[model samples]
Target: MTGDTQSWRRAAPASPVTLDDVARRAGVSLATASRALGEHPHVAAATRARVREAAEALDYVASPEAARLAGGPTGRVAVLVPHPSRWFFGELIEGLEAALRAADLDLVLFRVGGPEERAAFFDRLPARRKVDAVVVLAVAVDDAEHARLASLGVDVVVAGGRVAPYPSVGIDDHGAGRQAMDHLLHLGHRRIGLIAVDDDARASAWRTALADAGIEPEDELATTVAWGGEGGAEGMARLLGLRTPPTAVFAHDDETALGAIRTLRRAGLRVPEDLSVIGVDDHPLAALTDLTTVAQPVREQGRRAGELVAAALRGDLQEPLAEVLPTRLVLRGTTSPPGAPR
Candidate 1:
């Protein structure tokens, strides 16, 4: 029986119903039916209804090209990332691609990392004729850019930050900062150092969270460094040289935290003993390093952003679309009560 089933499964199925058949059934031109299927705004409501009914009866599914011919979507989404090579952006792109693939759509990646690239890309509106939606990663842009993005007539989904009038998906950086501060406060750390990166918003959030916790972070203790381990090491080295060096450090991301740990180890200091460390993102390396940190759903954020794009395309987004995921502190070997025995 299994062998017979296998042979049957190998047989080809019938060809899909085409737009011509739908048009014929609806008593309209192929172009009209295509326009109706695309849901072109110019198509009259009555004609669109008739054509859609015909398509349903015929089970007609329009191909990507057919849909575009009718002024519909191109079945492609453009993902804009600040730094494609960075670990965080890489993880996000992976999740976005996975979700897009599941929906039978295509992904087009655009790296607009620096100011020049970003300005050039936006000015050209390269996605205008290329994609149906745009997913912008963690990058700051002014109101004009956001408005220009919307004017391109493509659905925009902002991931990792909020741009009004467009759906956004990300964890609250300020809230996550508060959680990190809360964890460290309970651990009895007074002077905390921050190994921050290029994200000014997140840096400000961390500072605000600290202040709200009644812990005024010292200006000299917080240093803006490069992204990743190298930058983290440099920031830690500077922090360690301070007259009143911090007993604990909170890095912006896990890579930064790992780098800080490397610096401390080389300086003959022990983690959670001489100086505890905590970071955000719970990066892949965080577990290996046993780093105590706040973990947000990076991949999930991307997936949800993709889902939002799909929803907007289907006209399923009747309300303002926004998804703020939660983050939690993952306690590990890197953090402990200050002055506690190792």
Candidate 2:
């Protein structure tokens, strides 16, 4: 044998250097070492560097097969979606699928919309060990649900929304809301109303924008509904029943804006002539229907999220990242100055 081979054989330990040895040498917990080696974003940079240096000193090498058998990467990612049938979710899925496919990873979709469905999914997650990571698509994970995911020992990524302590890619909801509301305000529409699914950032923006414009937001002008077209239609009907209806309305999304227009048409009113309207998310149909809206890059958010998942799996993510894309106002035929001549 060569001299170097002989020296290596003499210096090598009787047994392989275990991860425990590296962790102990690095002065970190076992989990911290694993997370450091795995490139989890939550680990401190100094800790990761120390752990890596310890592994090098100990000549420790991680086994891929052993890691896989012990709940390591399976080349598949689990994607949790609230409303997969909706246009927004569909676009997200499309972009995510493309990026994951390019990275040679498979996507497993789970619909966790209702409370019962969410409960069941979280309750059974511990029993399932088929995925390397979980990607949440526009679903707000509660404290309990987040704990359940934490117990899974897998990385989590969020798309289209922000969840604490996890990497995410999305647009600024408050900014998008401002784009829609400010467009109406610039059109000289002082009496504006808001139709929202929830009192989220967008709703907050509505209130803030009105206050900044030196106008007090009326409680009667803000109406919350379920979601989608039907809920929007009902909200619009309620707004119309008010003593003084708004000269302009800001619906939560394009679908909601379309529903409001339906209500207006039923009342024999013309858009931008009798009243102006605006919304967020330039859905595909929004352009066809001439709905003015704040256009957000829904698909790009998904694609970026997929990239994050890939980076996490490859042990390259140095820190938790929250990437916010941009939103812009898209003026269409639906919005104009209040009582402006058509």
The per-prediction tally of clashing pairs is: 0, 0
Work out the TM-score per prediction: 0.78, 0.84
- lDDT per residue for candidate 1 within 1-342, as digits (tens), equals 998999888885777888778877876555456656877553567777888999999877778767555576567888888888887888888888888888777998888988888887788774445676788898777887876674455567888777776678988887887788778877888788888886565677667767877887689988999888999999999999999999888888899888989999999998888999999998888898799989999988888888876665554453556789999989999988888786
The parts of candidate 2 lying over 4 Å away from their true place are 1-52, 55-72
The local distance difference test score of each candidate is: 0.80, 0.86
Judged by whole-model lDDT over C-alpha atoms, candidate 1 comes out at: 0.80
- Candidate number achieving the greatest lDDT relative to the actual structure: 2
Winning model by TM-score? 2
Q: What tens-digit string does per-residue lDDT give for candidate 2 at 1-342?
A: 699999998898678887778878987544456767877554567778998999999998887632532343467889999899999999999999999999888999999989898988899975676777799998888898988887666778999999988899999999999988889898899999999999999999999999999999999999999888888889999999999999999999989989999999999999989888898999999999999999999999999999988777655564678999999999899999988887
RMSD list, candidates in order: 15.2, 8.4
Candidate 2 structure, TM-score to reference? 0.84
lDDT, candidate 1, residue 193? 83
